[model samples]
Target: MPRLLLVDDEPSQLKALQRTLRGLCPDLHMDLALGGEEALTHLRARAHDAILADLRMPGMDGLTLLGQAARWQPLAVPMLLTGVADFATAQRALNETGIFRYLTKPWEPELLRAHVCAALAEFQHRVTQQTQAAAWQAEQGVLSPQELERLRLEREEPGLTHVEWADDGAVLMPALDAHLPSMPR
Candidate 1:
């Protein structure tokens, strides 16, 4: 099950969000925090797949909390929800903290659910890739500089490269051409 953390300073707003999320996504494990500090506490206790925090708060605004989250839980997806539709703040959140999404107050339940699901899926993909890379490193000892560069390129531009794994654990990159040599028959 995907775990999520919701942060809002207002008690009523936080409770309402929790209620709506529970009704919309009963299977999701959700936690509510009254403020950024409380949210940080929850984040420290366990790993959450996604975090949605209101932009404005009394202490440690959403952006600040998100920056901390970025360092602490780099894999977790962070989202900003605020009543104020400030583009500057949104840009800062995206550029500095890498927020997954910026949602305004009074968000549509369905849309919110969709975004959260997408973020969770992305977080899962990142976690899976990290685990696979770690396992490969352990099995193959240390990777060569060229191999590491290839892996990085594959991740950055997945469509630009086609990778094949040979029986002896060799990575093969074939040119994108119809007349390319075929495997021996």
Candidate 2:
């Protein structure tokens, strides 16, 4: 199940939204926060897949919360599901907060569901990529000098010949491709 954090000041709005989206994302685990401060508290409580936040709120607005969230959990997909979507507000949110999505007020249920799914997919992809990168780094730690040199050579010359002088060419392959003859003058 995808864990979600929703931040808003209005209790009624929060409840309605939760109800509506709950039906939308049956597999989603949703949590509520009354304001940005509460949202941060919830964030610190546990790791969540995504965050949906309002732009306007009392004490530590969504943008501030997003900035802090990024610092704490860089992989978490934080989105601005706000009513306010003016040019300046959008610009500020995109530039300053690193928002993944900006969903305007009175958004469609289907659209909301779509966005949530996309965000969750992106979240999963990021986690997978991070895991793979970490594994590669760990494996690299066990490599011998010869293996490291082979990797460097493969990177530097995609189709390097194993033959004669190139200063110190790491022999990536035992023999160069026989298909391509040496260049004609």
Assess every candidate by TM-score. Answer: 0.72, 0.73
Superposition error at 17 for model 1 (Å)? 1.3
- Tell me the TM-score of model 2: 0.73
Model 2 ranges off by over 4 Å: 142-185
Clashes of each: 0, 0
Relative to the true structure, candidate 1 reaches a TM of 0.72
lDDT by residue (21-122, candidate 1, tens digit) is 775554788999888878877775667888999999998999999888775577789999999988888888889998989999898988887888889898
* Candidate 2 per-residue C-alpha lDDT over 43-162 given as tens digits, one digit per residue, 9 for 90 to 100: 655667888888889888888898887765666798996776788888888899778898888878788878878888998898788657655865878656665565445333322313
Alpha carbon lDDT at 32, candidate 1? 90
**RMSD value for candidate 1:** 17.3
Q: After superposition, how far is residue 25 of candidate 1 from its true place, in Å?
A: 4.5
Q: What are the candidates' C-alpha RMSDs?
A: 17.3, 19.3
